[model samples]
Target: MAPYSVYVRAVRLALEEKGVAYRLDPVDVFAKDGPPASLLERQPFGRIPAFEHDGFRLYEAGAIERYVDEAFPGPALQPSAPRERARVNQLTSILDSYAYRTLVWDIYVERVSVPKQGRAPDEARIQTALPKAQLCLRAINDLMDDGPYLAGAALTLADLHAAPMFAYFTLAPEAEALLAEQPAIKAWWASMSRRPAVQATAYPA
Candidate 1:
């Protein structure tokens, strides 16, 4: 599960959406002894959310999500139309490349993880990262339309990719304020959060 990892949450939600049964094995990447050798063998980087099914090994959240969507039989997570698929990929990329770092690393790690480890929140880091996080939210808002989901009317990989990150971001007061300015994104997030898949795979907050 990786505990609080958004990437792990994304994969777990996708699997739940597909109705795939699986077991979660939480890994502590920051353990004093380091990640287990088994995990390192499967994922060279010892990253969370690595999957192994019937001898098929996969890592990386994006690749794992796509594979789950295609490999399993259930509701399709991606659109059939080429343009819609592109839009899904585009939004997912934006979240992965921009929002993930600022929201998760700069804000969540500082405000949530640090405190949990008995350290105080890094106000300076949060202040430095808030503007960049705001920009990421604005970019997503600009890309999104009036549809109920990120890639349009139907939920797609884009929404799954974004939902977890947004969940964590909302925990940060500064990020929450920035999010309020983007009504469309806030509405979309509200819609995504209610889904059974999302609810089932929510991050442990």
Candidate 2:
């Protein structure tokens, strides 16, 4: 929703993995009229995914994902081991802080969103952001283990957090070319894409 909001997609994937049924209330923060009062009330920052579950309100994709995993009954998305949980959090942070801006705002917005809006892509911005985005991918690949998942043998919040952004990244040819060089990341994305939960929540390509 909101034209490539990976943060929202992260929360949706977590909910799907937990088998929690929820309705989506889409918001266009860029609308001429701006966000509605209800959304602003829940998310004062005027962001895309402010969730409401059984009268409990939550914002921020990471917090929403943790709540979904803990509050619902299904396979655990978080690792129980302290070290593994820490690793999951570490990857999530990297995606949010380092990768998201360059990958989504700079690359995806320039290549996909701008073109859709009938504006030409800013080639200069894409060129500048590519190396930073590549560095983010390299960092993630280095943190990854030999296991099938990002944290360990099982799916964790890290995988969910990063998948949506990767999906968006794949939408742009330039970003896709850069991703092709990351074998570990490509393998991980393949595995994550096969998950039923991921398939269900995936944004249209």
Candidate 3:
């Protein structure tokens, strides 16, 4: 699991939030030769953050987050009530299905990462993504009731799912204006960004 991957960081945040001790073995999926055979053995998709715990192996970030919360003995990362739990699941899904690609890959990668690599940003791509990114932010903001967190009063897997993406999305130049339109998410970031787990798993600057 690379420290820079949003999915990898999401899993790590769950572990940190749960007080679960673990080691991260780095896998470079973007290597010139393609993903290594060792990672392929653990995860056929060759994705970052293939996991193993007590001989039980897992791949997807969401599954691993739930596993860590259920298998560990720390503070609960999910709410017990069904409705709240549903909200957590909904928000997590939103981040995965909509927000991740629109905000992280479309905007962040084109606007920030590409520029860092000495490549000109794709202005047309960024322009096209702006509306979709705004929609994602609005959807998440609409789901919030009265909160310090995404799902509700308590911190849940939803926050962990989003924090990593937000970490990078905020670095994009377009983020300030988009986030300004969705104050709820912006405020959520202000608080979530300070958490020990988020700080611990932060992407390098």
Candidate 4:
């Protein structure tokens, strides 16, 4: 009943934390799952987490997250400083654009570049991205100065990024190895994954 795959649970937790009432319309991502007409009428990308609030439509996970936080506002997410807010948005973009999909590669591509189908993924994509993921991890480390939190001392949209990915990249045996090198990210992820709101909302698909 949740629109969430493990990938988008953070949005759900935000909704729950804010105490917003809504229904979950789970979108099956594996095999072209969407409403009969076209997902474009709902979400142009045919992606999950598209919301229909009283016939008003919206898309994009981050936009949905910010909307929910603003609309409900029980346990606020965004910080006051314009710079801090910029950092939150910036880190989210970096994660979404570069780092988010790579861990899936490390999984679906069992040998790190070859899928179960025996066909190889683009060697250039992996080579290009692994280093980028490393940089993202390092940037996360640098973000921890004010505290372990990403934007500042408080939990902000930065922590939302972790709740969604924990079950995915994490279940892999290699996840431990991946975390070993990235101490800051590991600490941030572990700390957040243990929080009461996150724990309560995590249903693991």
Best by lDDT: 3
CA lDDT, candidate 4, residue 13: 71
By lDDT, the better pick of 1 and 3 is: 3
**Number of colliding residue pairs in each model:** 0, 0, 0, 0
Question: Candidate 3, residues 1-205: lDDT per residue as tens digits?
Answer: 8899999999999999998889988788899999999999998988888999989989999999999999899999999999999999999999999999999999999999998899999999999999999999899998888877998888999999999999999999899999999898899999999998898888793
RMSD of each: 1.5, 1.6, 0.9, 3.5
lDDT of 1 by residue, 1-205 (tens): 5757888889888899999998888778768888888889888997788898899989999999999999999999999899889899999999989999999889988998789899999899989998998899888877777667887888888888998888887776776688789888888888788888887776663
For candidate 2, write residues 1-205 as lDDT tens digits: 4535788889989988888887887677777898888789989998878988889988999999999999999999998989999999999999989998999889988999899999999999999998999899888888887857777788899999988887888778886677688887888888888888778876663
Better of 1 and 4 by TM-score: 1
Model 3, total clashes: 0
Candidate maximizing TM-score: 3
- Candidate 3, overall lDDT? 0.92
TM-score of every candidate relative to the true structure: 0.93, 0.93, 0.98, 0.80
Stretches > 4 Å off in candidate 4: 1-7, 32-38, 107-129, 203-205
Once fitted onto the true fold, the runs of candidate 1 whose alpha carbons sit more than 4 angstroms away are none
Clashing pairs in 2: none
Cα error, candidate 2, residue 205 (Å): 8.0
Minimal lDDT window, size 10, model 3: 196-205
